[model samples]
Target: MDGTMSGVGIDIRDDGLARVTLRRGDAGNAIDLTTARGLLDAATACERSGVRAVLLSGEGRSFCVGGDLREFARFEGEALEQHLLAVTGALHEALRVFARLDAPMVAAVQGAVAGAGIGLAAAADVTLAADDASFTAAYTGIGYSPDAGVSWFLPRLAGPKRALDLLLTNRRIPASEAVEIGLVSRTVAAGLLADEAARTAEVLRDGPAGAFGATRRLVAAGLTADLGPHLDREARALAAAARGEEGREGVAAFLGKRPPAFRSAASPF
Candidate 1:
């Protein structure tokens, strides 16, 4: 099923893939109140449908330029403050929902990526940028601060010093530099961006879903977990996975020298 809500497009495929596109391309896909709510709705839909993977992309030249400053400019004083709070509240909740999903998300970014756009890209499990893409932390440029998990994601992805440099300078960096600094997974030719992202998402969708979910949680937790406790957690997860349908099928397939049908195997996650 496919639907367009405000400035966001959601397409849930029969193969368990959710394609979420930012549809306000003419406005550089800027996030307004409606767009923020739409994203939350889309994320909620994907979760309800139990999609195995998600692919995020834009409709036009730019992925997203960040929050709609033009919209914000219309309000003043407490009105403006309240408007911003609503916007960030919806956007941040959407990000949290996406992050907690068992499905992995892949983002295909092109052209300009700035402000909260950086947060969306960084939040993805894998971010594929086109060679023509460029990134900038644009919040500081407008006398605003970071939102949409940018402050948290940046430091973790690119190191504290680099994150601070990007945030403070608001300098645009090429896709090459983004990959080198661990801001993105890899860069692809602009023409191939869509196809490559879809291919990657398809692979993830076909993999073992339950194991992927557990692994995702484990990796995120490992960042702050101590070695001893983390190892114990890993042991419990491994043991549980071994008894699951996907794991049993995987082992059987290996011994039989056959490819495992992970999609057919029921996932307990």
Candidate 2:
């Protein structure tokens, strides 16, 4: 169940709960060019594995510190812009894959969640933070605009005003206040963060697969789609879920007074 895939480490349970951990803890789990590609590779593997849920975390004191500034410093002008483009391209691909997957993402965040790290954490369908976990939009402080989908995810998550406040001020917020501001779903004791995240992932694994995925899609589309097309999308999604195996099993199980065994479904993406 445990192996290294690209620069990321994966542990897949028989029940289809996959753990995707950032492996460069020694370096604060910074996202270098290699790590960006590694993330895409790991996400692709997860899709192929038919994972029902994913628990994302890092191996050390920090969840992720964002891009590797040291690596960025190695370039200048056009070289820097090109390097950034390459890094964001890979990172965006990974994020897109995860967003399109049926499996729900649960991020177990601790320590620092800064810059692009903030985007990574925000992208999760649900995020569980350690009591000591902290969040900051470090992009502006470093004279950079947002990347890694932070600009897209933050406003929807923390509201436009609050999102801009974080982006412009680069103020660090503790986990407790993070929950208040809708930055994280919940906070747990630092020692129990792993267990809590796994429990959340297991809950998601047991959920009705197509229905859950459809719900995520509906919510996301509601943010941008016009009311008419959004409603059409929802209708189609619901009908598709109703025609799926999990939907039938769910209905039958309810009628029979039994637990539904909702198996993992391959992501359409």
Candidate 3:
């Protein structure tokens, strides 16, 4: 859509917010070689976008349909293995970058978010949704297993039983139910989704850039490793950064009973 023949479409508005939209609505935002590469490229672009926040969403009815069946139809044995390797490897690398972004990521899900889309959303720091949003594991029902890091994200977010049940049954979970199940952070009206997402990003943009990144790192570390060390590291970083320019401004503003302005761009990791 960006005048390029890629499966995914990426556009960054001047406000420093990048939106990665799955443009292949005809086949849903199914994962293909082009899409996979496009995904990595988009993540790289976002990392350099100078945007304080990023949102991953879709352009049409469905968020993403899953892997492209058309691409897989040509697979035999070794060729299939090669294709899978390339796609998954590229995606995982991009996920690591996306996860380490300094500013928060809020995945805005609307309509259908299936399979790999779940994996993508789970990688985000936060997820917001519309009531019509629905989720499906959509792997086993098709005689295939999970890919695009779905296995890792699903079990961690939804728990083992929940993950297994969804993958096995391919049941649909609506946005409201998803929040209740701890799958999404908030559910908003479909019409206000864009405005809401922008507002949230703006709020984070006003905060200290270093503090935001440090806090995100702490949460991620706590999720995967020991909580004590994570807190300890966070405390140390906060103390050190508090002496910097941004932190000095924050302190002065608080003492003056005013708001402190901050730059939007920050480090990726």
Q: lDDT: which candidate is best?
A: 1
Our tally of clashes for model 1 stands at 0
Q: Would you list the C-alpha lDDT of every candidate in the order shown?
A: 0.94, 0.88, 0.77
Q: Please, what are the lDDT tens digits per residue for candidate 3 over residues 1-269?
A: 13332766776766566677778877777888888888888888878765677777777777787777788888979999899888888777788878777767877778888888888877777788887889998888888899877887777778889888888999998898788767788998999887887787667756677777778887767777777777788789889778877788878889999888666223332
On TM-score, the stronger of 1 and 3 is 1
Estimate TM-scores for all models.
Answer: 0.98, 0.93, 0.90
Q: Name the candidate, 1 or 2, with the larger TM-score value.
A: 1
Q: Local error of candidate 2 at 189, Å? A: 1.1
Model 2 residue 1 CA deviation (Å) reads 5.7
The digit string of per-residue lDDT tens for model 1 on 1-269 reads: 79998789999998899999999999999999999999999999988988899999988999999999999999999999999999999999999899889899999999999998999999999999999899999999999999989999899888999999999999899999999988899999999999999999999999888888899899999989999999999999999989999899999999999989888896322
Residue 248: error of model 3 in Å? 1.7
Segments of candidate 3 deviating more than 4 angstroms = 1-5, 264-269
Please identify which of the two predictions, 2 or 3, would achieve the higher lDDT against the true structure.
Answer: 2
